[model samples]
Target: MTNWTRKALLLSVSAAAVAGTLTAAGAPVAHGRPAEPIAPPLAWGPCEPIPGTPVPAGQQCATLRVPLDYRVPGGPGVDLAVTRLRTDRPEARRGTLLVLAGGPGGSGVRRVAQKGGALRAATDGAYDLVGLDPRGVGGSTRANCALPEADRHVVTLRSWPAADGSITENTERSRRTAASCARNGGPVLGSFSSRNQARDIDRLRAALGERKLSVWGHSYGSYVAAVYAQEHPNRVDRLVLDSTGDPDPTRVGYGWMANVGPAVALRFPDFAAWAADPAREAEGLRLARRAEDVEPLFLALARELDREPRESEVPGVPLTGNLLRQALHSSLDSDAGFAPLARLIRSAQDPRGRPALPPGLAGAIPDEDASVMMAVICNDVRWPGPDSGYAGRVAADRARYPLTAGLPANIAPCAFWKYDREPKPVRITDEGPSNVLMVQSLRDPATPLAGALRMRAALGDRARMVTVGQGGHGMYLGNGNACGDRTVSTFLVTGKRPARDSHCPN
Candidate 1:
């Protein structure tokens, strides 16, 4: 449920039918076709008995052994952690509805716990709710790059330049991070592509004894679900893609980072309205007297920080202009994040006190978490290099959208990745079954509405869309938009979709 969900998705689309079972080779599987040969069945047991994350009661867990490299089937296997909340009414149970969580880093086993109750109520026991930790995630076959602690810190990992927006430190760190991953991540890290995750989804379905899967995909999960729908169109039932990003094959993950420029601009007004509201006065969170004054006040503070970085409670790491700007971006992922971000800002502005860092930026990420986050994106598609005029683009993006402070346009380790692209990035086409439904928030800070529209276009008539007039990264159960939630849950339960694009007002 963190702000970002782009984690690991393995496999790439191919032409050959992945019949009998999809080996790691990622043999292309046709849509709707029921392949006879299936993977071994999963051994279901108590999930709460496990240590890490606790699953809800009645939620059972299982482990499926998928090939580390599908291309090399019959080789060593990776344990994919899977969970399911069975229908309360067996007579009403139609099939399994798989929920793919956001984050290349989001843990599906955990997401199932968070949204399980709401989903059961929405579907009225019509389908079982299922989810999994994709490869490289928790409870699954885990992999770590063993990156340096300094490089793993959010402030450093994000490639935010110095206060003045210089790229010197950023460039060195990007290259170093990439080098360490290439040296330490090994094959498991290399195996974290979204295409592969699509294949992994099929394997999960086979293990669950489901001929086809109903999907509720969120954030990066939307892209994974789209890939599965494209590769095995026949194998999908009702597909709900929530908070999707652009399916631009060439840019993939890198483009998503860049789109933050427009995404933040589109959603900042909502935050301004919240920040300047009279209701916030009691909390000492008001940034300005009027909503219009919020933007100027924020920009002024950032510039002042740029000139003079203030020390944070966290040792060594100071509160810089970009850190403040990045905090704003993170807050917009959900309205719930608004108060903490506001408090952080207010603390930073205190002249006599040490500013506190946001939890996300206070410390370095876990090595395995950071590794997969980078591997999945880098493995999915290529990013721009210095030769591509990224500096010029960064300058333009920063000028046009100062709120993002050019971090969106800055280079990432992917720009200097040593590994080659997988079988290639998967392109979403209209050739598959028309089973996909999309729900998007108009003012989402991440995966903006514009990208979701492109995804809508890419799916062609194969998909229908519902636009929720809200401001958040995820719209379904997370954002509490009843119209949007009902629209999606109905499609899952009844397999019916809106005939055309529909808008649900705030």
Candidate 2:
């Protein structure tokens, strides 16, 4: 699986800016003040519509006030941005299910709005759908490092190297970017870590009057769910982890990025098959007569771009090797993205044609999103202190997984990040409730089968996994086989986990 897929598979949330101590010392304390009890009837207010959004009917928005530091509930507080779709079938209602979005920075409110229907349908309307914008995201308390727009651009922020594959530019950029965030991003920025997100989820759970939560966590959200399950096992009723991560505390963000190479290599064949099909000729994008030939052609084309970029649809933004690779990386996550990639490839090779671009490359991730992503990863763990170490790993990865080149193993802003890890990483264990049900794709490029196996083993007997014999991430009702969907839905509605790990054939 590709690293992004794995990270995506783990949950929608990425393991970026996760720092702080999950120590006993850090636990919420009352000091001299009594704790505020969670009450019924949530304080209702008008939700600030998401920028470029249309509010759905019956969806209510509100602010959830939580302790800034769980230990000092009375000292200072923060507001959690939240949205809810109350149970459509109140007569059949079970309780509330929270949608934990991935990306320590991703907005849960948006995810719930987008995916709430699917989740409700999947559960047969057993629960209400709730999503929250984690701290530092939209509608919640926000923060920014206010760095130059150039440095803040997505491509630069991700540490994508220069066209020639040199790390000097990436290294320097990482250092400068880290320095800027440290200088400008303040205390609020420090609070945007994973541990706090878990705390916030718990706070929301308490606020909602739900004794237990049935959770649907995507990408980075899976990690958050796993940690929540570990911390408050009794508070969980049913759990679904989509597109999971390695969850290896030792590696954290760096290890997550390093896996990208193999992830791309694994998912590339699916794209190759689609591009080489006879049906694709009408699109003017077919690259090979046979599927095996696609990787070599892509590699050659990337190398050629490395030597010389071609004019792209985006003015001044030449289609360089890294850009092509990143596009391929993004596109391969779903079958829907195949056409744009093929069109781009065809445009690049076509003397008179233009390759189309994916939206991610069309523009940078918004500044707020970028800042949150950068902050959480750097804050979550301390990266290797030296550039040489990254260089060595990059060279080694390039040899082992040439499809992604050395991009996965390359230096990121975290390498030169300002803060050291303040908390020990949460080790996901099987001690959580057996209510967890994991759904995964067999041929997923992002969160590969091998990594999911580790998650399965870790959760041992405490969970059951349904393996969809298909490609892409988020197997449950998402680019997955019917059998897989049925398996997850059955477990979610009936609380009947599979007796053992099972497979769903395409």
Candidate 3:
């Protein structure tokens, strides 16, 4: 609980497994799933160990070489760290299932290593599970802005306003941070966009010798999956998009960030209900006598912290209002986050208590890690500049949703970033294969149901959507949503989708 500890937390966030585009003029050449050629045996070997989460014994790792830019396939290439957990029941094996991690910054290798066992069990050994770290992320081709340590911290990167709630500092930080990334991040960094990532996925498919891929792409990964499906339709057998952000082709990443204004409002009540419950008393986390009162209690606390931040276990970095908001944003990703958030609230309220920063926010994120987050979002598409009335938007956002206090709506480095080398963000189309299945949580904060619906709409008749009456970012294999999980797994194993768009009762 020192400043160093908090800094440690930030570095981990940057390193945590968490990344580009193609265009309309060069629209995807019409194609379907590639030929059903047997993928050559992976040079299977033991997986590298990850701290805290051990790799399942069955998992194997390998690397695929992909060009940093698809346009020059003959040019220099980067290694895509790939992982696989083969089916024990090879006789029952269906095909390969690609698992895509969220966070334009998420590490696919780490994600597969983490979820391999449960995925194998859930799919009944139906397919060999495979994952690939995208460029600018873990185990793949890496890049960094070498951003000043001061700017690498998530708190600073998050665009939180000054104590008086002024955006002047935020604007300068945004500009400075953008300038730093552009200066230190070279060609590799410039190539960090969704369009490139999708192309990389296809190249991996070729390397694996899989004709058709069954993919499960979560959160930001869902958008990646959608783009893949659109670009190469026939090559996909079954596509599952879980907990997706809105892919308004025009707005891209910034749109998703702005939508957070309404997203948290939608998901916060669930946290409130949990925090107000009688059962929480056992945990010393009960925050309010009634669920309805939880809103005022939380908003007031944020304002109080804004006025006077409390000292945290980490030195120098006090428990400020935006930090609480940051923790809340992450907590809404699932119900499991409820207790810790409640505990944080309890700590902040205690005069003698010191709040511990959330694991993801306690310290500064890695330079490369922070770079990945910033690069992909900043490069994927263009955003509002100084003339775009961002201050007015932030003011409106803060006025309408005091709980968010404009962090969701504030200007990001992308607003000042240069994306000249970045190709157009993928246009998710309804013309793709009808093999896609989307699962969404009704009350997800990070990727709310509303945004998922936009994705469903974009996919149109090409996809079937299942909305779950739950409260979390990921519904399938997450959030304990049995109905939702079963729905997705059934479709994957049996190839039968719901008759129509449907709801999975909580």
- lDDT by residue (210-306, candidate 3, tens digit) is 7789999988888898888887887889999988888887887777887777888998998888888999888789999899999899889988998
How well is each residue in 1-506 modelled by candidate 2, as lDDT tens digits? 00011112112325322221112113642322324345335676555555444556677788888767666757677677788988778888888888887676777787776677777877878888899888777677766766666665445666665665568888887777666667676667766676678777877887887778888887778878887787777778889998787877776666667666777777788888988899978767788999999988988998888888877777666777877877777676678878888778878887665555555565555555566777766666666775458777777878788777787778877766665335466677877557888888776766776777777888988988888877886676667889988988888788887788888898
The predicted structure with the larger lDDT, 1 or 3, is: 1
Q: What is the lDDT of residue 231 in candidate 1?
A: 81
Candidate 2, which segments miss by more than 4 Å at Cα? 1-41, 45-48, 51-54
Candidate order, lDDT descending:
1, 3, 2
Summarize candidate 1's per-residue lDDT along 434-456 as a digit string, tens digits: 88889999988778888889999
Estimate the lDDT of model 1: 0.78
TM-score, one value per model: 0.92, 0.91, 0.93
Candidate 1, backbone clash total: 27
Off by over 4 Å in 1: 1-25, 30-37, 49-54, 420-423
Which ten-residue region of model 2 has the weakest summed lDDT?
Answer: 1-10
